[model samples]
Target: MWEATLPSSRHYQIFGYPRVQTPPPLNKRRVCLRFACPSDLQSRLTMRRRASLRTLLAACLAVHVGCYVVERGDTRVNNHVLREQNLVLEERAENSVHSLIKVTESTSTTIPAPQCVLPPGMAEEIQGYQEVVDRVIDYVTTGDFKGQVYSHLANLVDTFGPRMTGTGELEAAIDWMVEQSIAENLDNVHTEDVQVPHWVRNNESAWMTLPRLKQLHIMGLGSSVGTPPQGITADVLVVKSFDELKKQGLKAAGKIVVFNPTWESYGVTVQYRSQGASEAAKVGAVAALVVSITPFSIASPHTGQQYYSVENKIPVASVTLEDAAMMERMQARGQNITVKLIMGAKNYPDTISRNTVAEILGTHQPKETVLVSGHLDSWDVTQGAMDDGGGMMMSWAALVVMRKLNIRPRRTVRAVLWTGEEQGLHGGIEYFKRHQHDHEQFQLIMESDSGTFTPQGISFSGTPEATCIMEEVLKLFHRINATQLTNPMTGGPDIAVWEKLGVPTGERHLARGLYYSYLTNLLHILNELFFYVFLALHY
Candidate 1:
């Protein structure tokens, strides 16, 4: 946690720099400065017996290196020019705050101006299709699907329970979607083969063996290694973070690392579940157990995919928050915690799966494409009703509404029901590999991996031009209160690969809904999603 601090703006002037806070008091230590500085100031910079850090700062201030100000107090402000020159604030030695902040100059602009460089008349161009967008909303809300869309989703999830990747059930679900696409008479209704990993979680169990024995609720993470038939019985070393594990160091050796990270949003905390095993194994830990990645939890464990390094593979699973906290308390009280975990999880060779694709050929630019897709795969824990079932239905419904309403788009509107998303986006990756040769043809890519119930609009990532166009397109959804647009770090993992190649990507955002809940705030959501998808084709 090093801080590069500088004097406050009130006391010192940094020419063109932003305001910054004063650095904390530095220890009075004898040190010599041998850094690049003005020749006149360099002579005054020398080792003085018991010289304070203040003297050094005053010397650097005299030079006023450049007009470009770096707010040292704000570490978040990146000056790439300094980085490119290998300039850094290097601490002289251990236990010494004595350091130097090297700032240099480059002719190019250090910081880009904050401006939305939209193409001229882009908004007006998108507004031209307002009438068509209205028709899409009307058709999905009152025409064919209106009240029956939710029922269709309910039937799909209810009929095909958990559609785990590489499972026959998932393949069956894919077949059903293909049949439905054909039944709807969508052109190019076909399936592309995707080879996906097969990780099976057969009967697994875990229980406490020390500090009062009790059965522990657990779910093995995807692709986790299975314990031997006799199982792994070892003392548990509870840690709240990877930093704590590093502090404990060798204490984790031959132990089961239990992670009980405090809730800090799913994006921040889920890392413990995904990479805790490898991190634990790095310290010679035999296995890792992470608290379920959720803000609120019943006495149930959650499961997600975990990646293991080739050299540091270890068994990993999720324990309920209750159990993780219980272990945390036991360890804090100087009680030795021990647990026995036995999992029958196995990873087989990658097998063939299919990504269902259906398209409405364009009326004008037939070769150009606007793809909307969602994963058909789910974790084996329960029926993935809300995980992505709604997304799948909505993407499919986009094609359905366009077909039923006889709205042929200028660019091809393709709906892909991706498989093996839970196993780390195998379907989407395969799609990218197969279509990358014609990458320019794809104008926009979107996915709804986030729960689709309680719709709020979409999060997007794109060039300023693309973002401006998307914002205008979203205006068409304002009637349903779903026109909000946000720029996120990413849209979603499935469509994320294409975003790298400068293709605009959008991820539908929802305000609420649990992944396991079967009850969805339907009908209205269908209005948003169906309208969201169908209208995107107009781009």
Candidate 2:
């Protein structure tokens, strides 16, 4: 730790700037500035006296130019490298507590925003399918098919607890989907067999053995190696980031690395869970435990897959938000903590599964297919009603609704319920490999795996012409508030695979909310997905 004290008596003037008067403190006329370096690097510099405050800073910067971080009254400021620029200035308002402005060499330029100019002749192209668009909007909004979609989804999830790949329940769900399609009078209903990896989690447990004995809620990551029969009992090393772990170096060896990173987004935080084990193993750690990637939880530990290095494999698991926070706080207080973890997870040989497909053949162009799909597999913990059960139902109900309405498009409308999506994209990969010859015939592809929340709009990914067509098609659903068309498109994993074939892909957007245990709430999503896929087929 390096400490620099700025006495109130000293007034300062910045380089090539006007002199400023110091504001007097209400009580004491003294202010102290403190900076800390990494523990391993703290021994390189010693706090020493100087004739003036400027001289003291010069001495601190002389030891390690870019190592020191300045803090005032417990408020941290970013550390800067003074290699190129000799002067760094910080300004603070007199009455405001948190107002800070930092001037550096790289802050001289301003970044420009990207252009998003729309092309011409969009409204003219939209007039071609004006009548069909109006019909789709009217049918989706005023249809009395809500109860059918809800009841079907509830029955599926309540019957099949978890639809893991290659499991009997997943196969049963696939068969049920096929039967429902046949009952709905959907044409070309069939199933394509796909081999999927089978990994089972028999049992898992974790407990804190030091500082205070406590049981931690944990779930073994998918495909993670299990501990020995005796279990792994080692001291806990808490790190907020991989960079912090690198700084520890050999100090992390022979310990259980617990990653307690702050919540960013799911895409950002999930990397820690997926790669934390291999990174820890490289440093000779016994095992790795990561905080769940979810933003909020009540003693709930979310589980996902973890990949291991071929040379350094180690056990990995996810702990609840509460347990991770507790262990991190204990470590920050300099308390010695140890954890014992036991997992009985193992992987077996690949098992046979299938992807369920149903189609409504086109009257004009039978070979041109407009595809809509959602994964049929999910994590093994919950009922999977929200993860993809709802998405599957949404896609299935789309074709059923079209059949009931006696609406036939110029291109075939296809609905596929995929399997083995949770473990990876096995079902989708197998489908593409088996049907690569027909790839050029695919007109448009969309999937609904996000969730079944209140429908907002659609996200489209395609060329400028396709985008303008989709924009005009969505305008018909203005009554339902689903007309927002964004250029930067995002869709589910299954549809993302079709982008390689230059097919236009899309996903239904939902209002920000969680999965409630109700089937009725998902009816809106069913209507939106049905309408979007209908327009994709016709246009």
Candidate 3:
């Protein structure tokens, strides 16, 4: 039998056997114990004692476990402090992520204005022309030319309603423009041949039948195909942009994809119109429909060109805001919807068109030219009154005004009305090719195509020195409220060819907000002064 002892207190021990000898301590105040056997009978007694010792050991272990539990309670307090620190760090990280997302969203939509730099001799030139600026304004305000301008615009819109490329109305509009140019008495009036594509939209309509049946006003996008004569009817899958569509993958197959991206400006919003169809088709979608982006919602569907890759092609179209809203509501209800599309839309072989050019020849440097231009073509939806007709008229008026002012610019000013700008820059590209050899002869090219708004200022393309010179020229227009000068010309579609060919370019600044609303009143005064100034300077 084996017996053991352990310390119980400073002067006591937990004994496994009676009279167990105590061992010497290795260090002062330390205690130890030892076991010894005397005879067989005593050894038997020791065995009995050992059994009792087992019971005591079990009791001791229980006591130790109880003390350890108290120690564990203290450790739990330390763990609580660490947990609270982790929670605070997590909250701060979440806030930072939200702030970054907001900043990224805001910057994506804003349009930045170009920088302006002034040139030497600008002050003197502006001072010399102060009276001329006042006279120009008086001539515009007092003149009753507003009626005539309105009449011209009304005639254009009435004669050509929704004239998409390749339509007879589009050709008629071009012819009418040429007649106007010839009537203006400008020199070198003629047209340069160009080829354009024709796309037609047939009968098309959309509706939500399951959640609620309601007719939707929609128009087929340019270059889209007609549904089978019977039309395609299917469930709709809505996506915010192309990325979301990709994530849906095969789930979108055989369904109509609705793209509902919002855009603050036409420049940024236009991407969905141009690429939504192709992207949807790549994922096996049968068709795609995008919400119209225009702020003015008159139930008028705007149509523009949509590109198709050879491998992925699908029918595409646009719906007015009101109609898009109805579709969204129905989709949210988990009800299936169907659309009827009858697009007579088809692509024809490219056909012939032309870019019109007219000029005011210079006396000393007849070969050197200063160019002014605007595109003649427009989308088929609206009257195109503000888009380019106003630009064309304004440029034409400028030439006449220069003559009236008797200000013969050192270089001859040439005016061009471009065609096929809606498709690709076809007219401009062709012009560059034909006139590439004489590019160096061009001193400057100015364009007006943004909109028929009030005069704002001008932007220039040239050496930094030349841009400064142009800015100085703009100071003369300050009295008329067009004083801002932007660096790096916002070249027009018609004049882009010259710019790309390395010819210097500039764009007239026009007010954007109120100009489109009162274009007629502005044009009349502008036309009157233009011819008066042009003749005075040149003749």
Best candidate according to TM-score:
1
Per-residue lDDT of model 3, residues 450-521, tens digit only: 665466666455665555455556555655556555444543556755655777776664434332223221
- Listed per model in order, the count of residue pairs whose N, CA or C atoms clash below 3 Å is 0, 0, 25
Each prediction's Cα lDDT score?
A: 0.68, 0.67, 0.56
lDDT of 1 at 87: 21
Q: What is the TM-score of each candidate against the true structure?
A: 0.77, 0.75, 0.70
**Candidate 1 TM-score versus the reference:** 0.77
Prediction RMSDs, each to the true structure: 12.8, 13.7, 29.1
Candidate 1: residue 132 Cα off by (Å): 2.0
Better of 2 and 3 by lDDT: 2
List the candidate 2 regions with Cα displacement exceeding 4 Å: 1-142, 513-530, 536-539
Tell me the lDDT of model 3 at 23: 24
What is residue 241's positional error in candidate 3, in angstroms?
1.0
lDDT of 3 at 40: 18
Model 1 weakest lDDT span, ten residues long: 11-20
Which digits, one per residue and each the tens of the lDDT, describe model 1 over residues 70-186? 234322122222221212222223223122233222111122112444568766767778788888777767666685557767777778888888798999899988888899999
Candidate 2 TM-score over all chains jointly: 0.75
